[model samples]
Target: MLLTRTNPVIKPRTLTSIHEQLRDHGVNLFHTQMHEREAFKAMFSFGGTLETLDRAQVNNIDKAILNARDFASEVVDILKAAQNAEGEGAHLAATSAPMTSSKVA
Candidate 1:
């Protein structure tokens, strides 16, 4: 009997790495916009409530969040296109596979 052994080492992508990739793809606003959103979230968490914030502050926060979302969507599209170009379903296959080991006695 023959046993098949598969060992795959996958490195998780970091937010900074992803942001760099997005920048390489010409979507440079992702990091800045994400930081803006995070700042808004921190403010809201520390502050009493949204009602306590001024109208302009709220609007700016909303706009920052929306911009971040839009930038993220664009990054997704760029990554999908790159995966498709490399090979159809390549990304899916890489992510789904697990390392395996077999022992025989």
Candidate 2:
């Protein structure tokens, strides 16, 4: 089975900003406190370390993966909504403006 991993391209600052924006919009998402420890260990550990992990440790990693996936999905949805809203606003502005023509006789 292929497990989906969250893309690591997002910088920490951008991630924090996303989190804050979500919070400001009353969207509660990306609770890092739940999987923070497990994620930290996973980042610092060697490739073969999973084999040595206990059941609980493995479970923690699993939860972290799920959380990461959920967080990423929510971020994508939020960005898409923002993009659509901007497009609508631009369309509305263009349509509401008065049309003027300059003619020389």
Candidate 3:
């Protein structure tokens, strides 16, 4: 639920916000690792064949998905924190920009 893409723009904006937040925090490893991990998951976890998987295989896949829910929850928590901080930062930036710019001029 961290991604509310009801509006098409929200997803990209969220991603940009996350990247900016990470950059501001001087952490590239988290973002890079997450991207690579997602790519690996998509490459390996997908079953593209028409042949049906066996019962145990199906159960295993189901279990993997269930276990991933915990990971998803953790990712959501991280995203939420980043989003909350980004919102606060934006508010502060807006309020301070004019004053700072006038002082600079």
Give, for candidate 3, the lowest lDDT window spanning 10 residues.
31-40
Q: Which residue ranges in model 3 land beyond 4 Å of their true spot? A: 1-53, 58-62, 99-105
What does each candidate score in C-alpha RMSD? Answer: 16.8, 10.4, 14.5
Candidate 2 accuracy as lDDT:
0.59
lDDT by residue (tens digit), candidate 3, 6-26: 232234676778767867887
How high a TM-score does candidate 1 get?
A: 0.34
TM-score of every candidate relative to the true structure:
0.34, 0.52, 0.39
Q: Arrange candidates, best lDDT first.
A: 2, 1, 3
Q: After superposition, how far is residue 49 of candidate 1 from its true place, in Å?
A: 13
The list of candidate 2 runs beyond 4 A from truth reads 1-34, 47-59
lDDT of 1: 0.52
Answer with 2 or 3, whichever has the higher TM-score: 2
lDDT of 2 by residue, 4-35 (tens): 23344444776568667778888755443333
Regions more than 4 Å wrong, model 1? 1-59, 88-105
Which candidate number would show the highest TM-score if scored against the true structure?
2
Return whichever of 1 and 3 wins on TM-score.
3
